[model samples]
Target: MEPNATTNENLNLYEKAENYTKTSLELLKLKTVCSVADVVSTLTSKIAVGVVVAFFTLFLNIGISLWVGKELGEYYYGFFIMALFYLIVAIVIHKTHHKLIKTPIGNTIISSILKEKQN
Candidate 1:
């Protein structure tokens, strides 16, 4: 082939490669945006549920405290007992922080991303 022909072929090949790269990059960006959106949605729902559950637990605790006080005939002692129970729970949660909180959260995020990819 002529030198000019070879140069033209090389240019065509380079153009193809550049087009391929652009397409790949666009696909990557789309996937990343989708993944981020999924994560944000999941977190939003989880946070909402957490807030609702927190309110429920608060009222439940208060009710139990009042009941305990009524049974024992000392109003504030029930509250103290409820507080002690919470303290113990807090300590247990603190000790198992990774097992109870971190791992599950990480797994949830990872699974959400992976699930998005699968779909």
Candidate 2:
């Protein structure tokens, strides 16, 4: 091959390698974004789950209130009972947040973030 042709071929290979490197970097960045997004999605879904559980708990309280009202013949006492139930549920959820973090997926995400920070 002529000297000029050989130089052109080398330049072409260099350009291709640079392009590949750029693409790889872009993919890594995308993966990092996705990882962060996964954490956020998990957090948002957990919030939605907590809301659903709370609503169901409230429904149970309402049902209990209705039942008790029928038995005691006083609708107002049921409100007090429901309040107590709400208080108990709130306390239980507050106490178990750390416990929930021990689940497999949660632990993985937490460990990943911690590792990232250490690096």
Candidate 3:
């Protein structure tokens, strides 16, 4: 083979490599965008659900408190009782933060991201 032909072949190979690199970069960018969108969507939905549940819980607590107040003939005692209940619950959740909330949430996000990658 002539030296000039060999040089031409090298240049052609370089061009193909550059093109491949650009294509790979674009694919990576697209994947990153998709991953972000998926995670955001999951979090948004979770937040919406959480808000709805929180509202339901709040109203339920208020209703129960009012009923208890009527029974006890004291309007404020029921509120205190509800507050105490919530305090205990908060403490328990704080103590078991990792097992009850953190780990599961982490695993869920990771799994969802991985699942998206697989697709």
- The models' CA-based lDDT, in order, is 0.94, 0.82, 0.92
| Error in Å for residue 36 of model 1 | 0.9
Best by TM-score: 3
lDDT of 1 at 82: 99
The window of 10 residues in a row where model 3 has the poorest summed lDDT is 110-119
Residues 15-105 of candidate 3 have per-residue lDDT tens digits of: 9999999999999899888888999998999899999999999999999999888889997888989999999999999999999999999
The alpha-carbon lDDT assigned to residue 27 of candidate 2 equals 82
In model 2, the number of clashes is: 0
**What would the per-residue lDDT of candidate 1 be over residues 33-57, giving only the tens digit for each residue?**
9999989987999899999999999
After superposing candidate 3, which stretches have Cα over 4 Å from the reference? none
Which 10 successive residues of model 1 have the least lDDT summed? 110-119
Native-to-model Cα distance after best TM-score fit, residue 85 in candidate 3, in Å: 0.5
Q: Arrange candidates, best lDDT first.
A: 1, 3, 2
In terms of lDDT, the best-performing candidate is 1
Which sequence of candidate numbers ranks them by TM-score, best first? 3, 1, 2
TM-score of 2: 0.55
Enumerate clash totals for all models, in the order shown: 0, 0, 0
TM per candidate? 0.90, 0.55, 0.94
